[model samples]
Target: MNSKEFLNELKKYSNDLLVSMSFDQIFKEELLKLYPRKIINCHAGKLPFYRDRNILNWALINNEKEFGISVHFIDKGINTGDIILQKTYEIKDSDDYTTLLNLCHKECASLLYESLILFLEDNVKAYKQKRKKKGGGNI
Candidate 1:
């Protein structure tokens, strides 16, 4: 849980690194000397909206019609990253929080895997998602 252990473990992964710190708590001193590269995060909500936690819950509560996943570049602002790729799915009225979340999680994992493959192949830059611009998702 501490910084030293966290950084050490992160260094073990190839092409993947983990930093155990709140976005606000991560300081430049901890990473300034390290390699400067694009850092991306997959989010459950669409960008410029639904920017915080419990995305699926929010979608269900708001009665959205569709929900999707977004892979984007991390920026100083939350959920404001430049989108790389997005995949969406229809939300059924019978879908609850758990169902919606499970679906979104599956899509997120797939997107990340596909994006990594694309990056390795030098075939793409990033993905951008476009959500349904209508009513909220099913409750």
Candidate 2:
């Protein structure tokens, strides 16, 4: 079924929360209108910094000493929503893409579980990302 149709069916249920993981499609505005801040997602990146796709590859290419998993509210922008929880894992010298990805998979699962528990208990808070100033370098 299409997203709209799926959402239409979803509205029949009484649940007030939606959790998304690794969903490639964007939620339609109509769905967002109905759900608003009720939709949440877990990302394998730190967010805002690694907002778009291929985050793990980029982190490895950038030689980052650490990588992060983030759970946040789903907003219009890609991974620009308020952060609910984040945890970082150190990048060991012997780690490859596969190993790092496996680590992230585990951490992401744990973070998602904890975040959901906190959210259900009303102990979680969303923090908006602080905007950074654009560079003024001349073209």
Candidate 3:
């Protein structure tokens, strides 16, 4: 369904919170307006880094020794919202596509749960992700 129709259907629900898990497509502005920054999303890759699609494959292709999972608020720009939680993991020589995928699956579930709890308790201290600068250490 289109965003408007989907939103109309969502209005039938009683909950006030919205969380998007593995939602590959970006939401239309109509749906985004419904929750503003309150809509949270769970992304498998580190923000401002392994964003977009095929992130896992990219990581493997790059022979990355570390990976991450990020849970953040969804904004107009995909994977560019303030981060709620970001956890990194080490990749070993034995780790392959399936292994990495499974690790992310596990971490994403637990971390998303933790992030929501922190939000509910009003204890979350979200920070904007800084992209890597020409000579900067942060990204």
Candidate 4:
């Protein structure tokens, strides 16, 4: 089903939180309004930097020394949400695209677990991204 239809169905359920991992479709403003800070997303790249698709490829292409996994509250803009947790992995000389991708997936899983714990405990203090700055250090 389409995103709108899916959302309409979702509204039938009573959920306190929404977790999205590698979900391709963008949540519309109406959905965001309905959910507010209830939605969270796990991304394979640092926010306000590698915002969208193929982040692993982009990091490799850019010759980055490290890459990160971020969990944040979902907002309207692409990955422009308040960050909840972030973790970085070093890029080794021997690492190829596949290797790096694998690493990202592994680290992402761990980060997600940790972020969820923090959220459940109400220990997570999310920070807003500075739109003026394009990039920053790894977490």
Q: Report lDDT per candidate.
A: 0.63, 0.81, 0.81, 0.83
> Could you tell me the TM-score of candidate 4?
0.87
lDDT string for model 2 (1-139, tens) is 2376787798899876888888888876787778888888998887657777777887878888988889999887777789999888888889989998888788888988998898789987889976644731111
Ranking by TM-score: 2, 3, 4, 1
What TM-score would each prediction reach against the true structure?
Answer: 0.70, 0.90, 0.89, 0.87
State the local distance difference test value for candidate 2.
0.81
lDDT of 4: 0.83
Q: For residues 16-115, could you state the per-residue lDDT of candidate 4 as single tens digits? A: 7888889987778988988889888889987767887988888888899988888999988878899988887898889989998887778878888888
Evaluate candidate 2 by giving its C-alpha RMSD to the native, one decimal. Answer: 3.4
Candidate 1's residue-wise lDDT over 11-77, tens digit each?
A: 6766442222114343233442242334667778766567677778888877889876777766555
lDDT of 2 at 46: 78
Task: Please give the lDDT score at residue 37 for candidate 3.
Answer: 72
Ranking by lDDT: 4, 3, 2, 1
Could you tell me the lDDT of residue 53 within candidate 1?
A: 74
Colliding pairs, model 2: none
